[model samples]
Target: MKHGVTVALLVVAAMAGTMASARAQGGRIEERALPYTPLPADIQALDEVIKAPLTDDFVAKSFTAPDGRIVPYRLLTPATATVQLAQARLPLVIVLHGSGSIGQNNVSQMTAFAKAWALPALRQRFPAYVVAPQVDVRSADYAPGGDGLLASHPGASLPAILALVDDLLGRLPVDPARVYVVGFSMGASAALDALVAQPGRFAAAVAFSAVPPDRDRAVAVAGTPTMQVHGDQDTENPFDPDHAWAEAVAAAGGAPIFVRYQGMEHRVPPDMILAPGWREWLFAQRLKSAAPFPNP
Candidate 1:
């Protein structure tokens, strides 16, 4: 097997026994089990699953920055918009793909959190826009380093991504009031930093296996309702730093919901996205401020 695929299998299999033990002791990754368990082989097939497009309809989209930088992104419109495309505006969920999903292809990133949103059940219940943008590796080093510090800015894609999001709002039926963000691994770290960069734009966040917080930046976005989930056994991104970050956020008056999966690791089993009303919880959160898409 290829090194990356082999590594992915090992990570998932190794964490399974631990997670099972934790669940037996009442551990949960935010109101749901990891969702891919009891069959190690199933967990191993994640790479192929992630590579396949969740739906054939995700539209190819782009945003051109002022400096002539064009960022590529894939967009999924809900199959059940309430009103006509031009007049309707529903909640929007911005999904950031993990390190493995980064590519110029545009759709590779759609398989992670974005796939969860594409579920037949979720598509019917939480009819909203799902946007997954591809992050290029050359512009920045995405991997968190030795001490769990990311090599680049946590919100490095800030201005460009936000510009794309803003443009989506204008052209598509996206409810500016109900915007939410969710991501795993490097993407998770980026999601949190995105909140810090532009506070009040995103009403809530679900960051899993996220990198350690940029304390100063993290503390700035204390008001946003956020959920942090990590496996104590996560070697890719150590568990303690994320736990401490959530604790610190709460200490600083941010109500971050932290979930420690007993034996989980970096792969984080994307199946958690389909565990009950996870998307609903995200859609329900609303920013207290009246301003739409809060500016930096």
Candidate 2:
């Protein structure tokens, strides 16, 4: 009886040790596999839209204006549009790429910025309609000797962009109030120009490492909610211009949110889009009305 009792105790201890080892192995497996999971569903859907197959019909559509200038644009719709539209018309976000991205192959610029902003990833958090308009210098006519003529022609880019927006709105269900615009570098400057030319066309504007338009132009859209993000160490475009513009906008009765990243350069930070606090701050603003109090 004593021998039987001792064997039973040994077997129980051995079983417990085996179970603990199994649990540890399982945990390690989970840790290793979790990172590979595709981003949230909405993000996955957006990424798929970015990577979706394209052809002349699906992309690179060209339109000729009455002035004989040709404008080309690309439009990306959510992959799960049937379901996403059911909830409500998804918000539209117009992404403008920087100067380096200008040319016949403008799609490259939009693709790069969309990926950098993690537009696909953000889709999981917020469903949006993304429109990318490419400004081709080869086709559009510019006034002679204008300083940064390409940069100044918001009319050149704005019409193509707005036409695309209007086309999308006519074809797809979209929420007018949630329309947003985001631009980087040269495109950022163009976004500002757009707001000035057509006041209140967008609900919000986000500019990164951009040169603010002329003060007179900026003041026209002073009431529009705008967010300016720049790195303190940005050499391409000095930080002072952005700071000065933010001050000017605020002085004109617009509350501009200025985010300065210390020890950073011209590139977008890895987690800027996903930062919980920033997201709350972005969604909280009312573009049509007065700006909210400074973020605490």
Candidate 3:
């Protein structure tokens, strides 16, 4: 009887030890999966090259989003002479393209920004880590009005964009405080959706020719600094709601700057992206006091 009791006690102790070990292992795995954590060495090197000097040679790569969907993106590193000699952990800009380029090859969307505005400007003065993620809308359903699906799904395009940011952060040294987002047309709606889904994640967001979402939970993004640019002649998305969006953002205690261009249309003009004072305006704005919108 004494031997049986001792054996029983020993078994209980062993089982408890096993359980503790299992819990510890689980916690480690969870931490490893977190988004903002530093990535492995190989990924870090690749990120550095992406932000390095541009010598008439550009590289494009593809990464898998958290939802297991492949997203193609382009990275243009400024030439060594162009890069700021003192700055480390370069600033990042994530660009979202319009609906016309949605189902097309990622190169079309990438070149639109990379070759158009980002690379040219960076080659002259500022060198930034630019990311253009192509959203594959072939598999996802869209509302009749061309907006995102009303029902939420795991692998939707908007979520895929967010996941792209997570993947980039894990693989690169991105400045959390200086991350910026720019979207056009359908992409503008996606930008607004992203801001609504995750508040305070971006330093600044610029949306051009955009329509406000049907139902935006303002409380989610009360702290994000945003810029709305609309052409007065735009008919597809219109400019009236752009004004309304700015008002709603202000009411939510956020500083939303709205720009209405004269004689502009639904297209994103080069002047809009290359405006002399635009970057200054974007950099000067700061994210301040973000409180939830009062319930009506």
| Candidates sorted by TM-score, best first | 1, 3, 2
Which portions of model 3 miss their true places by more than 4 Å?
Answer: 1-58, 82-84, 111-114, 118-121, 138-155, 285-296
lDDT for every model? 0.63, 0.54, 0.55
Q: 70 in model 1: Cα distance from truth in Å?
A: 1.9
The candidate that achieves the highest TM-score relative to the unseen native structure? 1
Clashes found in each candidate (C-alpha, N, C closer than 3 A)? 0, 3, 4
TM-score of each: 0.75, 0.65, 0.68
Q: In model 1, what is the error at residue 97, expressed in angstroms?
A: 1.0
Tens digits of per-residue lDDT, candidate 1, 63-102, equal 7866556778877787754445436458778887788876
RMSD of each: 8.2, 17.2, 22.0
Model 1 reaches what TM-score against the true structure? 0.75
State candidate 3's TM-score. Answer: 0.68
